[model samples]
Target: MTIPALEQIHRHASVRHYTPEPVSDDLLERIVRAAQAASTSSNLQSWSVVAVRNEATRQHLAELCGGQRHVAAAPLFLAFCADRARLDRACQLAGLSQDASTLESFLVSALDAVIAAQNAALAAESLGLGICYIGGIRNRPLEVIDLLKLPAKVFPIVGMTIGWPARPLRQRPRLPLHSVLHHETYHPIRDEDLLAYDQTMRATGIYKDPEKGWLARSAQRVQNPERPHLAEAIRQQGFALK
Candidate 1:
């Protein structure tokens, strides 16, 4: 029986281990088409996705993602790029001035790419395929642009790994509703709510580390040396997020 949509969404966990079964081109095409069908900013559709299937390319991308083996082992790897070059070219070809230089336009394309990538990720999960986002893809943005042959005004926002999951998984727990949800006005979260959430997460058994609390894990991530220098990396990749 198919699981409920809300349950599936809330139960999602980043799957790192995958089976040997390969994802077929036809299935991958459908996922891409579904991703394109997602809503876009002013219908500019300023995003591009590259599916990396070759072992060598995947290995290189895996290294870019801090040597995450799943990026190299997954049957399908997708790099989602925020692209303004197409619209700029179209404007120039039509003898019109392109307004793609603004920070707003850059943000729009970045948001659009993220939305499209999530659409594809959810669709793949719904089909029993496991997927994980490779945020480390941004660690070396200029190198990724060179590896992918991306044009000017195009930036790789993130990468994804997709394939059949190899093992039974535990669902990642989330913060309590009160911690995230608010009434019409944004209500400031209370200290009690934060403590309650930490306790709830501790009980979930999803996070195996002995940290025992959400705050500790979050703090560790913030202090992690492996985290990329995101702003400078994006700037180097031609995104002037001014």
Candidate 2:
């Protein structure tokens, strides 16, 4: 079974170790062009990206990302941003407000940024480059804002480290499709399915603590509020998040 569309992302894994090879500017420009081709909500295109290559700046960014060494070591780092700055300018030009305070607007911008980032990641992978998406970039959003020197109404949703892999990628198995896909409206996963997945996790050695099941971890995660200050950070970036 050859899936042509998926060949670009086949067995994709986040590569932490990388060689010192530098990603060229021409290659980066081509990747960005592919990213720009991604569709946006109502064509609002409320997204932007900042490519960082300076070692010193990357060191600061790596610290902001909670000491992720890969951020600084990678040949290229990109910050995918939700940018309402352009929308604001458009509003000013039209003498109309886009009501950027709404939660819907915020979600749209964030989704747009994420969608574009995915496109860029795929493009990079197709070119034999490794990429690691750094969610820790949000650990200290305020600092990232200052380090990146982003204008008002612009914030990095995620950071990506891109370079040539130093070693082979470790491919992790994904959950079965039945657990996610539905036949009709909606359906809850059966308990037996979780138990089976737990066994699979243990057999696959994917987790350090294989005794801990995904269902249990998910239950605890939903209750535990991660990144409680994200709303305030988003607000500081000029989004209302209403």
Candidate 3:
């Protein structure tokens, strides 16, 4: 019963290795247009994307993104930003006061950015392009902002690298349906479900050690003390987040 679109979705894998072939300007524009076609909260469309094609800029950004080489190697890198600057300007032009400093406003803008990015990613994948989300950009938000020349009321949500794949990648294993799907009310995940998912992940052989499964790896990531200072960075970027 799986449709072609669903099959593509299920086959998605993060592509870190890319070929030297460049993505054409027209294709990049089309992909971005598809992103703009995504649903926006209240039709405000409070998001912006900065396309980085320069090798020097991409290298600097790659370093800022915790030395992720794929960012520098990709044909194109896009920085999706949760933007309120345009809305604020619109309010000013209408002789109205702007109040986009609240936490709710920030959340809405960030959500819009995420939705747009997904749409763009799907469009790229449909066109036989590869994409990888680079969340490490958040590790040095101020540096990214300075490098991109982002104004106040605009905060980078995430960065994505897109290009032609160097080689095919296998789909990563995911948790079972029952572990995440809850009908009517929230249900606590059973330990057995987690163990089963861990086994599946181990069997995939992606990790160096099969014994260190998804649960342990995920828990380690969650407990990592080297988390990004996103809240402080957001505050500095003029988001009150109240």
Best by lDDT: 3
Per-residue lDDT tens digits of candidate 1, residues 37-101?
A: 99999999999999998889999999987888999999889999999889888898999966665
- C-alpha TM-score for every candidate: 0.91, 0.91, 0.96
Tell me, by TM-score, which candidate is best. Answer: 3
Instruction: List residue ranges in candidate 2 displaced over 4 A.
Output: 1-3, 208-223
- How far in Å is the alpha carbon of 190 misplaced in model 2? 1.7
**Model 3, span 55-102: residue lDDT tens:** 999999999999999999998999999999999899999999789778
Q: State the lDDT of candidate 2 residue by residue for 41-121, as single tens digits.
A: 999899999999999999999998989999999999999999999988899899997678888888899999999999999
RMSD of each: 2.2, 2.4, 2.0
How accurate locally, in lDDT, is each candidate?
0.86, 0.88, 0.92
**Which scores better on TM-score, 1 or 3?**
3
